[model samples]
Target chain A: SQTIHQWPATLVQPVGSPLSLECTVEGTSNPNLYWYRQAAGRGLQLLFYSVGIGQISSEVPQNLSASRPQDRQFILSSKKLLLSDSGFYLCAWSRGSSYNEQFFGPGTRLTVL
Target chain B: AQSVTQPDIHITVSEGASLELRCNYSYGATPYLFWYVQSPGQGLQLLLKYFSGDTLVQGIKGFEAEFKRSQSSFNLRKPSVHWSDAAEYFCAVALPMEYGNKLVFGAGTILRVKS
Candidate 1:
């Protein structure tokens, strides 16, 4: 069975600080990875998705960026965090087709103060 | 462009009552629809998905959704609601692009079951 893991389950950072959130998937290779932010009532907003190593497609252009350094490892980073950047970040993986069902990680709750 | 709309923002129902959540979508070509449930402050769990063949798709937790092509709607339904069913439900539509398909999500509907 495949499982996804995300770290720093909860994070608190001061404004203008650098941020990094990691996501890794086990038991699957060449899986498509995605980063999403969940707001109060706006639902899940796709931030970035990676098809392979060094390939990242950004859905929303903001203070955040994503990278796929390894086949199953995805990282979401921010050079400088903004107050608006605070939200619950979720990492997901899908096998074969991107349209297939995605499995989500536990998620990272970011609080930028 | 593909978009999804979950009409009801909040729905309350009795624990033993039937539950239905409305979802509408707009897309240029054939749409891939999905339903996901999120417990408070947690990641989404896929309830069901509709790709082809059957118009009705069954998912985990005794949940099902019917896809109406003409109506451009994929509504999720459950025969008997449980207290554990209280959560936020999201409707998503997959928009295919050159690179990959992006899932466009609705605002989401909050389901509250009264026991």
Candidate 2:
């Protein structure tokens, strides 16, 4: 089966600190990658998605960026963290065929204080 | 633009009772629909998906959903509820081929089971 691994499962950073959240899938190839954030009591919001290595599409503009250095490895970065950056961050991947269901990562709970 | 609406924020039902959750979507074409479940502190799990075929789709954990294009609704149902079924359910829609398979999700409806 496919498994998604996300690191630093829980993080707490000071304001203006840098941020990096990693996601990697272990059982698929050429999968589509995505990043989503969910504030408490809110729905998941799409932040970024990648179809392949070096190709990224941002759904919303903010202080974050995404990179796909390898087929299964994706990274979300920020130069300076803001208070509003604290949320549940999830990484998901899907086969680039039809409307294949997306599999989500365990997710990282970020606390920016 | 593509959007999904889950009218109910929370619902409570007794065990062994029938369950139904409503979902509605807005898109230009035949939107691809999906239902997902999320346990506390876990990622979203795909329960079922509707792409192009039959309107009624069966999913894991004894859950099923029906797609009604005329009503722009895809409602989820369970014949009998169990305590283990207490979780958050999400309704999502993917715009045909125009959006490159991006899924737009609605505010999830949380389900609570009464013993």
Candidate 3:
């Protein structure tokens, strides 16, 4: 069974502070990784996705960026956080096949004040 | 462009009652559709997915969805509801191969179960 883990289950950061959220998948190798954000009372929005190590694609331009340093590890980083950055961040992975069904992690609740 | 619409924002049903949730999507070609469930403050769990072959797909937790291409709808249904079934349901559609397999989600429908 594949499992995705995200760190810092909940975070509270001051405005202009740096941000880093980590996501790693166990029991799967070379899977497709993705980062999604869900604002309060809103749907999930794709922020970034990675096909392999050192490859990251940004779906929407904003203050954040993503990096895949390892086959199973993905990191979302920001030099400075904004108030609008507060939201529930999720990490997902899918099989690198034609039929891709994403599996999500527990997610991190980030509150930027 | 790909988009999804879940007409109902929220729905209430009694235990043991039948349930149905509507979903619609707009895409240029054959779309990959999925239904997911999310408990409050938690991540999404895939209930079912429709890629091809089967128009009616069965999912976990006694949930099923039907894909209607002509209508551009993938509606979820449950034979009987349970209190534990209270959660938010999301309908999503994946863009064509040229779009990098990104999923566009609907606003979601919150399901409330009455005892």
Candidate 2 residue runs with Cα over 4 Å from true position: B96-98
Go through the candidates in order and give each one's DockQ: 0.60, 0.65, 0.59
Per-residue lDDT tens digits for candidate 3, residues A1-113, read: 88999999999999999999999999998888899999999888899988889988998899999999999999999999999999999999987765478899999999999
> Chain A TM-score per candidate?
0.97, 0.98, 0.98
| Interface alpha-carbon RMSD, every candidate | 1.8, 1.5, 1.6
Q: On a 0 to 100 scale, what is the lDDT of residue B17 in model 3? A: 100
Clashing pairs in 2: none
Second chain alone, TM-score for each candidate: 0.97, 0.95, 0.96
For model 3, the stretches where C-alpha displacement exceeds 4 angstroms are: none
